[model samples]
Target: MKVTITSIELKGPFKFFALSYRAMHILRQLKATNCLAMKKRGYWIKHYTMTLWKSEQDLKKFAMSGAHLAAMKASKSLAKEIRTITYEADSLPDWPTAEIMLKKAHVIHY
Candidate 1:
């Protein structure tokens, strides 16, 4: 399946909690056939999230959807600035079985 690795660096003094909530709302509206956490790392108390998708089209559709669009419009008003790197992957490999994936990833276990 296709995948998109979005690395977002949030600007300081931003409403991180609210923006995070909005991001989840946008992800929830995505029509992707499947989604999974890829890799995640954080520095300086900021947050980083990696999510896999069925295809670029599916992800782009969500980016253009209302919730995301509204968030984008507020980028300037944000307490933190944001930067995103979107990579369009041709194929993704090494997805473990559901049980294994669930058991291994702390956040996904629930």
Candidate 2:
């Protein structure tokens, strides 16, 4: 399986509502894209996602298209910081495990 974990800190509280709208689209698309499992955590300015897929290809297919694509385009503008990690795994990590991995992962400061 392939696991992807992402963490985003919005620039401000207001950005959460904006991102939430886009997130709705992403959730709908995720189901259709054959994601094996997914989880989200955090509140207000902070948000995170841990997703499981059969392969990297399946994950990329959902990420690079649809509302997710739009969200990516808005990321630099909407978020204060973003962190991401992708790796081959036997299963999706729990929120705490994902958070631990994210600490050493790539980060973008907006």
Candidate 3:
């Protein structure tokens, strides 16, 4: 199976609890509409979000879909900003669990 992972790095100071809540909201919203898996980590207030998609088309569809587009646009308006890079994996490879997915994703960026 193919997996598309999105790695996001937040640009400013953001309360962890608040961002986590927002992340959950975003993930739930995406999961309701598409096949999506999400994870997050931090570094000096910088944060990373990894979203797994079944395919590039699936990923694109969610990105261009109305609610997602609105949420992403709204995120930019917040004091914190984020940069994301999407990666394609032909297979899960060495990842045995979702945790592995997060570790592998952390090692990859555009």
Candidate 1: the clashing residue pairs are: 11-80, 11-81, 13-79, 14-79, 14-80
Q: Please, what are the lDDT tens digits per residue for candidate 1 over residues 1-110? A: 44443333455524566667766766665534345445544444244445566677766666776786887676555434333444545444243322233333333100
**lDDT, candidate 3, 1-110, per-residue tens:** 23544334444455555556666766666777556455556656556555666787877777776656765665654424444445666443332354345454434222
lDDT of 2 by residue, 1-110 (tens): 99999999999999988888989988988878889889997798999998989988888888999989999998988999999999999888777788999999899998
- Cα deviation at 86, candidate 3, in Å, is 1.7
Global CA lDDT computed for model 1: 0.50
Tally clashing residue pairs in candidate 3.
0
Q: Name the better of 1 and 3 by lDDT.
A: 3
**Residue 86 displacement (Å), model 2:** 0.5
User: Against the hidden reference, what TM-scores do the models get?
Assistant: 0.52, 0.95, 0.55
The parts of candidate 1 lying over 4 Å away from their true place are 7-14, 31-45, 88-110
Error of 2 at 97 (Å): 1.4
Best-to-worst ranking by TM-score: 2, 3, 1
How many residue pairs clash in all the candidates, one count each? 5, 0, 0
Off by over 4 Å in 3: 1-18, 33-36, 79-81, 91-110
